[model samples]
Target: MSDISDFLNHLPADRARTAFDLVHYMLGKALKSEDADEVLTEMAERIGRAGVPLDRATSIVPLLHAEAVASARFWERGSGARSYLFPYTPESGDGYAHSPAAVVHETGEWVRLWLPETPDDTYGIVPELKEAGYTDYLMAPVFMKSGMAGTFSFATRAPNGFSDEDLAFLRLVFPALAGAQDILATTRAMQEVMRMYVGAEPQRRILSGDVHRGEVMRIRSAILFADMRRFTELTVDMSAEEATQLLNAYYDCIVPPIEEAGGEVLKFIGDGILAIFRAEGAGNVACFKAIQAAQEGLDRVAHRNGSPSFDVGIALHLGEVAYGNVGSGLRLDYTVIGRDVNLAARVAGLCGTLGEPLLVSDTFRGRIADAGKKTSGGPVSVWSVGVHALKGLHTPLEVFAVAVP
Candidate 1:
């Protein structure tokens, strides 16, 4: 307490007051902001207005995602702010190893370079900043509650660079800034995890206040249900790690095409994937997109197939589904349940029994025919696989096989 008091007492009176106001803002309004980019842009401008001549500011934090490693936001005086996500690098952690942020992470301390005054050959960005008239660059560490270090960096075009008072004031305000940033980042990370495990549509609905148990929404969509063939038999002799690897490999082929075709993957039931395509009131358009996605997914699986290769059965149908929260207490699950979903799954069973990789319900085919528009990969055609009685269902379903081009 005494050390902090002395540090505060040593600051110029005006700078002390500025620092206090900025810290208060950091602890208050900044944490309430939706995302880090908004907070960083406003804070940079606010601090500059408060007598810190910063021309640029950046916020970097570790991201919780399957495809991305970390996220960075770059803020400039005139250009506002832009966000960038670094993908997972198979070798090292991308080009970040040679970055100033990495040095701060390694030493748990700040790194400041007096721009052009210092040799710029050590880092490529230094020369670029110097050329852009930046005279000072500082990277400070922000220790997050997750036991990882984030960073806030600043740059200035001021001729004399940042004053000693500027550094002191920033040092005083950093704890509050760290708290605000960590709070926002943690919330974002949780949202990312939600999207990863439960999928995008479910995450959006759940976070948008559709969270009450038994709460459901009746939605009309084209359903696509697919499962790996011989999953149990193939995995029976393999280790857990191998089976997981195989499933992930298969999903990589399946999930991407669904997403690319404007469909949402709702769940991964063991080796099975349940996805939906909706065009609001247009069931034909939804069926068209679902058909395209299924075709592309099979092509992808075929392309990615190799040693110990596997096959998949895909089913398409169109109807209403109950989309929303289920289960009880803290164990709530946001998913879809309806006759159409069941029909889609039942059609998937026909894929194996009928010896076809792709099967569609009669309702699905009718919708596609209504679409009438020329679909890619030639005009869509199907072969009648004939109706067959499926387990747990009273009426026999008429299933058709998607003819391979």
Candidate 2:
């Protein structure tokens, strides 16, 4: 390989200047941790101002994610950059196969197609590019050190297409662009992995260097503990794969409602779940949201009553929770703990024993009444399900079951 200094010396004066400026720009953006969209948008402006006919620019990275196949950002001459996700689907694959990027990815080759001379059927996107007054289209492979590949494409409205100098300048700056993209994509993938394992706040905290063990925050929260009913009996005859699917279906009924109501699902303890809703706005909003989330979760379970059905007992309690990192040695776990969390779990146990779908602790019930004072729904209706002796606690606690609307 030739030295970069020697390579730059061989380029024309203008192209060399543009390439040098762009390398510096890319480095600055990468060091500052600017997102790909911002980098691409600014890159297009700089290249165009440098006498390159860059009307549109795009960066597409094919990453392995649970839901998405690729992440794309496109910037146009007069518009701000926008992002799109190509989901893992047959249609997404079919669309990619008809585009020039797929060819660049498969062949590890660059493509420079003059859109005005090319047939509309040449590439799936050619007709749209031509209609948008673009005459030049270029796609180049950006291979990462991880062996995964991405594509960067440029389009221009200039009738003569991109000049040799323009193409050379872009090619010279490609390494810098690819380096920045690799960093951005890797960071995004790490964040995605964290999101899959932890709630939003925990993910943020961990990413922000707050991962030391014993780092905990105590806050008042409405805790909800729930466990699937008859999970073992229900899946006893099923195969492991089938049972796992059933469990996922059961969790689906519970997790979304909790997340939708601004509650964080902290842990999935086998068939049991522990989540919390912190008090926000006018005090008892956390209790109200927790109650509403429980009801919604129960409603979703009821909706899935037939064939492969799931039933759960949800219990809500209110108190302080110590939330954060707890573990030993090099390994760690982020979770919420406190007597209140235990009380919530105990109340959840009562749901199965008392044959109730939703149960609220006495403290939680009072908060519901208080929340009702501020909400349009008023106090949630409930009835005492008798004072029951929980496993750990000495005094018998009064259990209350919520009313169906």
Candidate 3:
């Protein structure tokens, strides 16, 4: 570990005091839950305020994401920070290959350019800095303990550029800054992964310390259950890769429309999807949106079908459900559980038997009626499939088939 105290002892008294104060300020901001961009911007501003002669600074940190890498740039003009997300592809035309940050990253060493003295043919950002009236530019690599690397570049417009003392101070503090950034980046990556795997609302609950098994909340919502028709028959003869591709294609057709209609997809059970449209205020908007989503999903799948077609069955129900963590102490899943959820699944099973692509339970239809005609644009019509006994339930359940327009 790099000790700030040890480094401060070597500096002259006045310089050491100023450096210590600045380091403490930076460290305090970093440790107080401030984000990476905020910390970096504050560090640059503080350095300039302490007479370090910094006019511009930029930091490029690579991310574990599908698209862009994150970066922040600060200019002295407004002392404001601007962030950018550079895409990973179309690499040939971005001019990133000839940037000073690229050189520092490739060589794992610092690159310094004195604008007036640097050769014109230098393969980096030197020419651009010279034109921008910057007298000097320096780029340093920040190599983390995990082998990930980032770049930090500093530029100055001062007549004499950075003094030796200023450069030395920056070199001493770089490690601490990089360490703070790594922590922030790792936290962000974990949150992103959680959001990707579980839905956003569940991830938020888990992060907020709702991890104990049986920690749950009862909430009214419209539950949606959907599954591919004849999935086993569809994939029995195909290779694993081809089967996987078909499943993805099917999801591509169905998932987005549900999300667009304000539903949270809970999980995928084999070829089936479980999602919920949450109730808002005192209305049955959740039920209405669930019905709309089911219709849109079926339409999308029908539109995507060609010679080798895929079909799906979906069902919706509205009632109270237990939403939270469940399972053994060693492992837990953030999901919903209740009779309503079970009822939704059972109703979905009737879709195939009734020869209907979409089905809605009596409970859901009742809620829509209770919300009044204005909420649902008047009474909606459905084909009543009289009370039928479902597996595990002794009482016969009334179900209705949705007539898609």
Model 2, 1-405: lDDT tens per residue? 245665565577877787788889887755585566777888888888778889899999877676898899999988979999988876778888898988998898899898767999988898898889998899988887767778899998887888866776777788898887877777777787787777677788888888899898787888999899888899899999988788788888899999999998888888899898987553488999998888998888898855677678999988877876889999998887778888889889878788899999888888788887788877788889899888888889998999855
lDDT per residue (tens digit) for residues 253-318 in model 3: 778888998888888887988888888764388888787788888888878855359888998888
TM-score of each: 0.86, 0.90, 0.82
Window of ten residues with lowest summed lDDT in model 1: 1-10
Q: Highest TM-score, which number?
A: 2
**What are the candidates' C-alpha RMSDs?**
3.3, 2.6, 3.9
Instruction: List lDDT for all candidates, in order.
Output: 0.84, 0.84, 0.77
Put down candidate 1 lDDT per residue, 1-405, tens digits, no spaces: 235565586578887887778888888988887766788887888788768889999888888988888899999999999999888869446467767888888898889999866787666578789888999999988888877678999999999999876777677777887888888888888899999998777788888889899888877899999989989988898999999999999999888889998998988999999999875666877888888889888988888855568999999988877786788788877877887888888889778777899999888888787674655544578778898887777899888888654
Candidate 3 minimal-lDDT segment of 10 residues: 68-77
Location of the lowest summed lDDT over 10 successive residues in candidate 2 = 1-10
Candidates by TM-score, descending order: 2, 1, 3
Off by over 4 Å in 2: 1-11, 30-36, 63-65, 90-92, 116-122, 280-283
- Taking all chains together, the TM-score of candidate 3 against the true structure is 0.82
